[model samples]
Structures are given as C-alpha cells and as structure tokens.
Target chain A: MHMADALVSPAVAGAMYAASTAAAAYSVKRVKHEDDIKKIPLMGVMGAFVFTAQMINFTIPGTGSSGHLCGGVMATALLGPYAGFLTMIGVLLIQCLLFADGGLLALGCNVWNMAFYGCFVGYYLIWRPMTRRRLSGGRILAGSLIASMLTLQLGAFSVAVETLLSGVTKLPFSAFVAVMQPIHLAIGFVEGAITAAVLLFVYQARPELLDDKGKSGRQNRFSYKRTIAVLGVFAVITGAGLSLAASSYPDGLEWSIQQVAKAEEIEAEGGGVYAAAEGIQSATSLLPDYAFPESENRMGTSCSGIVGAVFVLALCVGVCYAIRFWGKKRIK
Target chain B: MSKIEGAVRELHRVDSIAGADRWIHRIYPSVKLILTVFYIAFVVSYGKYQLPRLILMGVYPIVIFILGDLSFFDALRRLRFILPFVCAAGIFNPLFDRKILFYAGEIGITGGMVSMAALLIKGVYSVLASYLLIATTPVEKICFSLRKMHVPAVFVTQLLLTYRYISVLLEEAQRMAQAYALRSPGQKGVHFKVWGSFAGQLLLRSADRASRVYDSMLMRGYQGEFSCAAVSKCRQRDIGYLLVWLAAFVALRIG
Candidate 1:
C-alpha cells in the first residue's frame, strides 16, 4: 500500500526520507562484490521487470479485484537483502514517477514501510531461515508466502504506527486497526501466496540464482566498497528522480484518518493546515508540490509523469555510464 | 486505447491561470525538492500531542494556496481522499485513552484529542505542501534539477528509466487485467492457487526482461552516464531561481 501526500506531515515524511535513503545507500554498499557489469544489467532490468510483472494482474480467488505481484520478496530472494531492497526502491520510484502511484513525501514511508520490510526483514528474518532449513521447492514456496504476508502486514502496521506517531491521522488505534488491518490482511495473504509461488518456481528452474556464491561468484571483502558507493547513489537518485511523480493526494493513512475522523477535525482549508502550506511553499522550488499550479493545463499529471520517466531513465543510464567510464580510466 | 486517450484528453481539458505557469511550472525543480525536505522535516519532527502548535501547522501551506494559482477548494478536493487515514488514526485516541486532559466548554479534549489533532494537522500540512509543488512543476524538469544537484548521475538515470518503464508495465498490467476480467468476470478474483501461479509467471517474465535489458546495454554505447533528450540544456534563469528559493527555504526552516 502506497502512502499519499495528504496523510503525511512534513516532519514524518522528511525523517522517513532521510531514514530510507540512509538504508538504501547502506544496502547498495552491502552488495559490494556484485557491482560488476553482469549485476548492473540485472539491477536495471530487474527493476524494469518488476514493473511489467506488476502490470499483469492475477485474480485473488474469492475477491473480485485482482492482485499483482509485489516484487519486493522476489527481488530479495534473487538479489540478496541489500540489492533486493534497492531494487524495490527502484520499483516504487517507477510507480511514483510514471504511474502516479505514490506521493513524493510519502515516498519515504512507502520505501521504508513497503520495500524495506518486504526485502530485508522478509528475506533475512523469515524467508532465509525457513528456506535454508528445508532447502526444498516447497520450503521456498512456503517461506516466501509466509514472509511476504508477514512483511506486508508489518509494512501496513508500520503505516499505522508512523502515522500515529507522526500524529497525522486522527483515527484511534482500535478504529484504525479495524479499518487498515483487515484490508491489508486480505492483500497480504494474496501477496504472500503470490510471492511464494514465484519463489518456488524460480527455485525449481534456477536453483543457483539466489545463491550469489553459486552463480558468477561472490565479491571479496575488498569489493565491499562498491556496495556502499552504489547504494549511496541509488538512494539519492530515487529521492531526486521519482520526485516528479510524487502525488498531491493524502496517501493511504491520511485517507483512512479522514474517513474515521469527521468534518471539523478534517477541515481542508482551516488556517491550521494553510499556515504550514506556506512554509512548504517557501521550501519547494522545482516541482513545487510535484504538480504544477491550476493555471497550467489538464495534462499536468501526465506531463509530469512523462517527465519523471525520462528523469529516472536518464539518471539510471547516466550513473551506469559514469561508472563504466571510471572503470576504464582505472584500468588504463 | 481509449482509456489512455482519456488520460491524454483530460490533460488537455483543464486550463491553468496566467502567472501560474511562471510561478509554479517554470520554477526550478531544485526549489521543489528542497522545499519538500524543509516541510517534511518540520511536520515529522513534531510530537504526537502538540495540539495548538498542530493547529497552527496548517497555516503555512494553506496560505501558499491563497497566493498560488490553484484555489483553496480545488486543492482540498484533490487531497480530501487521503484525509481519512490520518483523521481516523487519531480519532481512536479518545476511545482507548480515557484520561481526560482538558474540558473545553461542552467538549472534553483529552490526551487523545491532542494526539489526534496533531496527527490531523501533520497529515494536512504534508499533503498540502506536496500538492502545491506537483501542481506547478513538470516531472522531467525535476530530474534535470536533480542532475544539476549532482545526485549521483547513475541513480538519476536509473530513476528516469524506471519511471518510464513502469508506465509501460502499467499499461501491460492494465491489458492483462482486462484480459483477466474478460475471462473471469463471472468468477471471483483468481483463487489463491491461480493467483500464486499468475504472480510467479509475472516474476519469471520480469527476470527474462531484465536479462534482455542487460543485453541491450552492451549493444548500445552504454558507458553508464545516463543522459536524456527530454531537456535541451539549462536556462540562464535557472541559477537565479535556485538562489531565491534556497534563501526562502532557509528562512522557513529556521523559523
């Protein structure tokens, strides 16, 4: 579940952005040995692949709405916790920029809540141990299903906790739980099963994939530097890149709070909110609130979306080339 | 095709105010990015119970609304959908939290009330600020701004690529969803079994796509610095704009 712009406070959103970027950079650095040409393509392509996979939806059995693949778990399984996490960031970045899925401020929350938990916690805490213990296709399936569901649940819960802590949503714990938990539970269950199936399938077909050591070979301790550097760049890029796609909406938590909290509490133009808007007004320069002013045009969002896509593509391609150029220089 | 066309059509349908373009759209993307940082830092750092301060929090962004091209009501209409979450999250503070803090005339605003108020305020401020920024600037400009900011060229490029790719994927997803709906409109959502199978199929397909993308990189003169044709070059005004915005951001954060 993506967080929208409406439900966030500048404070919580900023803190999360900082935290997520920090973690993202850390993750990239963690994949030091894997920063070779082979991995580069995989990283970029896998990021794209995640997008396409999300496009095709699968029915959720009894539910009328279909559920698409949440790539966090799959990425973690293949790319290791660190790389997987960065990849998930890539996925969310794409969603925000091109798809108008998440808000700019909410991007931090989404990256931390949705991506962090799905890749790292799900992989290291649950999937790894579970899969390792059994090492069977069924184990991979079961592990992924459980990990994915748990991760989503945690991410959803984190949304509640973060919102509550940030004091953005007025909904009390009980009522908010009543609203968020069940819906997410449904989503989580479906996502988990989907994640499990993918994990199982991959395990059967390319058993060596997840075993980084078994594949091209693990990077030595000396190469750890690459991981840190790559991750640092990844975080900054995503933060600045998909920023164009950051929405003007309230995100999931804020939307939920507005539902439970009545009118007076949820005044749209109350001087209270208007005051803070001015500060932000002082703050934003380029994209302002991610969308242009009313005087622009109807196609603002789409125009912004197209711009964002180009931004991300260029950023990614640029970084790769720069590195290649650097590598060649060092060799010479 | 029509749905895509509709999105395109809707873009052309709406019209913006006069000075809106120069003030909002033409502003450098760096201004938006920095301001976002400034605003988020302010909102997230506040504790859950600072009610009066929370109420005061909303003024800054709303005042911007007052000055900007977008009317207050339009901004609210655009953001109202997300209010429920933050609003609801705080409402429960009163129910579980029985200890009352203040009795304001008829209403008894407790610690929960304070917390809820803070949350609602936070949600509102962040939402408003973000809305105003996006409403003004286009996405591509933001990327160029990021590049100018020296935000790791590789990362910026990936972001651009990823953003472009997702839309294609979304269309693909939409197509797949349409196919799915056509096949199983009568049936409930895919069963868990089918759901897993379908998702797995997507992931595997993604992996293949990833491999193919990697190959293409070699074929092209992919030396790694990801540049784009979206922007021709920087404008002379870009420097002046960035400086003015940076000054304002500092003033707000310090205050």
Candidate 2:
C-alpha cells in the first residue's frame, strides 16, 4: 500500500505531511516525558528489528508466493503506541533511503497510512481492548489478526482517497477502492498471523512487557479520549475539505474550457470589447484552436507520435550530456 | 534465502556510496534535504495532464545525479522496485477515463492516457530525486541536519541509531534463516509454521541486544540528546544552491 509520489498531487502530499508530522510531533512530545526517556534505544533497536523482519519473507502455506510482516501492530503491542509510532518513522526513513521503497515526499503519506493506523487504531481500538480482559495467547493472536487487517484496510483506503483528492490519476474513488481494499485485505491476513505469532512469543517470554502498568493503567484520564478527540476532529476537517474539492473538480475543469469556448460565444454577440479581446487571442495564440489541431487524417497522429517520441528522447539525451559536460568542466 | 542476503547487500550499497567524496556530499545536508522536499512538492503539485511541464522538472534529478558524481544506471537500478507501484496506480487510467482529452488526427487521446504518462514521469522523477539525495548524503549528516532544523532530538537519535543497527539485526536474522534453511532443504522459503518461532527468536535476540545497548550508552556518559562536534555551517553557496533551484521550480510550476 505504499503510495508513489506520482500517485498524489502536491496538495494531497502536503496535507498528509501535515497530518503525519502532527502525529509524529505528538508522539515526540509524549516520548520526551522523563519516564519515557529510557525507551529510546529500545525504540531504535525495535525499528531495526522491524527492518530485518521484513527481509525474512515466509512462504504462505498452500500458495507459492512469499510474504513479509508489516511490524506496526507488533511494534505497538511491544513498545506502546507513542514509541511504536516513532520507531515506525525510523524504519520507514531507512527503507526510503536504502531501498527507495517509498520516496521522500510520499514518506509522510506512507507513515500515515502504514504507521499511524497500525500504532494508534490497531493498538487503542482493537489490540488493547481485545487483550485487556486476559493476556491469553489466543486473545493476542485474535487481536493481532483483527487489528492488523483493520489497519491495512484503513491504510489502503487512505491511499485511494489521497489519490482521488490529488486528482493525479483518473482513478475514480470507487474503482480505486475496489481494487486496493481486497488485495490489501489478503496481505493483511498474512501480516496479522505473523504479527500474532511474534507478539505471542514475546508475551510468553516477557509477560510484563505486554501488560505494563503504563499501558494498561485505567487511571490515565486523558490518553485515549484526548487522542481520539483530536484524531476525530482532524479527520472531519480533512474529509470536509476533500469533499468540497471533489464536488468542485468537474465543474472547475469545464469552467476553464467554457472561458475559452465562451470567448467565441461572446464574439457571436458582437461586442466591441469582446472583438478586441478575440483579436488579441487570435494573434497571440500558438495553436489557433486553443487546443490540439483536430485533423481528420490519421497521418497527424502518427507523425506527431513519432515526432513527440523523438523530441522527448532527444531532450533527455541533451540534458544528460549537458550535465556530464558541466560536471567535467567543474572538476577540471 | 538469497533474498535476505541480497537485501542486506542492497541496504549497505547506498551507505557505501554516501561516503564517497563528491561535491554533493560536501554541501550542507539541510540545503539538499530542503531542496529535495521542495522539488517533490513542486513536481507533484502540477495538474495531472501537465506532462510537458513535468518533463521539464525531470532536469532537477538528472543535474543532481551528475553533479553528485553518481551513475545514472545505478540510480535507475534503485528505481526498479518502485516502478511497479507507479504502474499499478496508473494502469487503470486509460480504462476508467476514456473521455477524449484532445484529438491528434484520427486518434483521440483520452485524459487517462495523458495523466498516466504524467503520473509515470512524476513517479520516476520523484523517486530519482530522493534516491539521488540518499546516495549522496550520509545518514548521519541527514540526522544532524534534521536536528539542526529543529526536528526533535529523540526522533533524530532514533533515526540515527536505527540506521546504525540495521546491519547488525540483518546479520542476526540472516544467521537464523540460514539455520532454518539448512534444516529444511528444498523449501523455497521459510515454512509459515515456523514463522512464529523464527521471528520470535529474532525479537528475543533484539530485545536482549537493545538492553545491552542502553547499558553501554549509560557507561559512555550518554545523555538523552547526542551532541556531536562536527556541526555543519551553512556557506554562501548553500543559499545560492537553494535559491537557484527554488527559482527554477517556481518557474516550472508557473509554466
């Protein structure tokens, strides 16, 4: 569910960056508490652990394909949400730098989609509540499976939503969701099972790690409620903004076209001001039709296709050579 | 099996390049970092059908790659894994958007086709820009610059430490995988049944190592924030670099 930079517009990327950074900032602040200071190395090491875990791809039984763990739910279950989220940022940063698995700009979106949901939604809503009554192995497994699936689903949906909002691709919202959700759902099940096994093993090894007082403390009045409230408000604001943009998008495109076509309509009415404007437009326009010259002959399409291909190829070659030339001169 | 080994080497490959003595490696990391973010933001900010303008912006990555003394083929190789994602995001465009954007003679070019081309261009360019940045800049410099830019010290420290220890953990994981593979011959990958215990063992080992690392840090007078002596001072060229690229990006965006 990693989104490429091309999949999002600057607006969508910026919005996600703001959202993810806010979450990261919140986590950083929470992590700065004196009590939380000692977990820094643990967070770092766990981040490494996550990175390494992804490499050990296990084959799914009865299927030839192999899959790896996502580690977000497991991280949260092991380290608590605040540290878990930060650890995720670390793992993601390394992955981006080393593998280019997700590019730099989309890092924020990747983190938001993959980390935030897994750490917060998985931990608070599903894992915590499900495993609260008793720290049984079965409970942990079930919690991990459900929470992992939920977070992956949420992440996949966000990818679709972000792409739609950006309008970078012509993927309609429903179609994009239809394609992304089910595939991610399958990946989520495998990830969930892997997560459960890992968590269960850790729970068996160190039960205190899973049931720490800080994590399970019912006395903390502000933790879950405040976080949920903040996230809810953020979601509402973003949702409202996206909906407004989505509704206006088609009309916006048509309106721009109307301004061009309407220029002729105004000329038909024969106003002096309109004629002068039309005269200027005709004189200044490179393409007289203000769009691609519609030719009835197939030759224009074929010719342009060849010409455009050559032009693009030549441009790329020219740029590369120029850079190389400049580099050599600078070195000399 | 071999995938694990390949991954470890790939992770190290970039770090090895980052240590090379190039002008890009010498520049203030913050400048390169900020410029990369701006370049991406500007590139992606364009309308979906703005293919020509997006193509112009591709110059940024090419220039950076050459100036950084990096190989274009190496950069392209790094981009191999990410192309599928870009393709997946865009493959349905021609199908979903059949509206004629314009006609080139007898043929009607759909908005989807134009946008798909634009999307692929944007994806490749953005990935290249990011890959170039990492290839040229060391992780420590990035973390240090990030700290200088007022990113939380804890977060930066985590980034630094995590990067440092990734190799160690990978080595450990590789050992376990080798052991598993030796015992279970002819298996293409690890059996799903052992994934629990296998990953469990890795976690146990990592937890033990993490505690040991914390103890070692305490013994070395490690405080919460890492204080390094090699603070990078921003030079005049750094500002010039930023302004020139910023101006070019703004111009392209306007186009």
Clashing pairs in 2: none
Docking class of 2: medium
lDDT of 2 at B126: 84
lDDT of 2 by residue, A11-111 (tens): 56767888899989978877776355568998999999999998887899999989988899988888888789999989988888788788788888899
What value does the lDDT take at residue A317 in candidate 1? 50
Worst 10 residues of 2 chain B by lDDT: B45-54
Worst 10 residues of 1 chain A by lDDT: A213-222
Off by over 4 Å in 1: A1-19, A30-32, A48-58, A62-69, A94-106, A129-135, A153-187, A201-332, B1-23, B43-81, B93-118, B135-138, B147-150, B228-255
Query: What does DockQ give for each predicted structure?
Result: 0.16, 0.52
By DockQ thresholds, what CAPRI class is model 1?
A: incorrect
lDDT, candidate 2, at B59: 68
Q: Judge candidate 2 against the unseen true structure and give its global Cα lDDT, from 0 to 1.
A: 0.80
The best candidate in terms of lDDT: 2
